[model samples]
Target: MHGLFRFLALSAALMLGFSALASAEPRVRVETTLGSFVIELNPQRAPLTVASFLEYVKAGHYTNTVFHRVIGNFVVQGGGYDTSYVEKPTRSGIPNESGNGLSNRRGTVGLARTGEAHSGTAQFYVNLVDNAALDPQPSRWGYTVFGQVVEGMNVVDDIGAVATGNVGPFDRDAPLQPIIIKRVEVLQ
Candidate 1:
């Protein structure tokens, strides 16, 4: 009886540990007018950034947002603007996690920000190519790379190929027809 009890206890602990490991990383499916792509977040590398992004995803904050900027061979940025070219309200900026060893490679998603290093809010961009210039340097903070496209990368490429021009406040790289993000759903 004593040996059986010990075995059961160990089994229970192992199951619990496995459960925690399974949920440590979360994946999100971004459904756009063009198609869908899956992003697997690296919470271990950028915990705060991943948490902030998941919070927005759970709240359906990405619905109706447009991929306003489509710079081919560069990036496709969105998650802030609406179909009307209006910026949505976002939570306060999070700390930069660019030093976490993730590179700005193709299919990897990075947080969008102004000149300030910690100004990343809800907006993010996927690298269309290996943008080595966006990587972190000793003198400057680079964009935080939190996740990467695990599936449907071709869909991201299709979105990147869309024609862009002046629209509303943006004088360049705005999709001539809005490439709407229908929704972003977190995968189990």
Candidate 2:
């Protein structure tokens, strides 16, 4: 009787552990003018980046922001500029987590930064193709990919196909008609 009780308790604990692992990932829904998509964030791999992104989402930073940069067959960058081409304020930069084993594959979401490493804050881009060049190398840091679009990738593709040219402060690749981010919400 004692042996059977111990086995039952261990099985129950293992089942609970497996269930926790299954639901460990958090998801967010991004509503854009074109459409909506869901992103599954990999906090286990890029904890800091995911946390920072969630902070921005909860603070309503992405609302009304335009997808300012759209390059066909390349990437669609946004989460910074407003409709009037004004840059929104952001918190301090998060450390680069590019080496966390996530690649810049198509539909993967990555933090967009300048030349400086560890300079990512709020701005993100979705790769339209497998951008192996954006991955980390032996001597250089790469863009951190913390999440991937799991649904409505067609909407992202549509945004990528928009007409782009020099607009406002951008020299080129700015969408002729702004692709606005309507809202971003965390999923329970």
Candidate 3:
């Protein structure tokens, strides 16, 4: 009987420890030409996506990148293009984590991918509105929402308001004046 009680206690303790670690969300401060904003990444909800984003953050992959796509009332995307509009190489795509329970709400950050279901690479976007249409449905995969802006959402709004026009091959939605991502840093 004593051994059984001891085993139960050990199991309970282990579970609590694991739960605490899982709930500890990672955060990053994204510094851009518009302003700086902090994002709290929910690893509990999107583990693989969070890990991949952090890998890029730590490696300085976002520095000097420009928000290549910006649509008012829609999204501001970056993390893969430089000031000269050159696409930066990234690690292979990650599996879609759209079913992680996060939504495409305003201020939420999502991975940018091609039409393929699981093609998220280095690019990401911040939703400017409650974009429910981008949420996952039974028949299709949606963009994965891995984080949300915890501070300076006004900065995101400011970026969304920038004038956009044709820039080379991108004949629409590119910011007329570049919104550069000066740097990105991981926060404790």
Model 1: lDDT equals 0.95
- What is the lDDT for 62 in model 3? 97
Off by over 4 Å in 2: 1-23
The Cα error of candidate 2 at residue 180, in Å, is 0.4
Question: Please, what are the lDDT tens digits per residue for candidate 2 over residues 91-178?
Answer: 9898999999999999999999999999999999999999989999999999999999999999999999999998899999999988
lDDT of 1 by residue, 1-188 (tens): 99999999999999999999777678999999999999999998999999999999999899999998999999999999988989999998999999999999999999999999999999999999999899999999999999999999999999999999999779999999889999999988
| Candidate 3 C-alpha error for residue 2, in Å | 26
**Per-candidate TM-score against the hidden true structure:** 0.91, 0.91, 0.88
Candidate 1 segments whose C-alpha is farther than 4 A from its true place: 1-24
lDDT of each: 0.95, 0.95, 0.94
Residue 87 of model 3, lDDT score:
91
What would you estimate as the lDDT of candidate 2? 0.95
Ranking by lDDT: 2, 1, 3
RMSD of 3: 4.2
TM-score of 3: 0.88
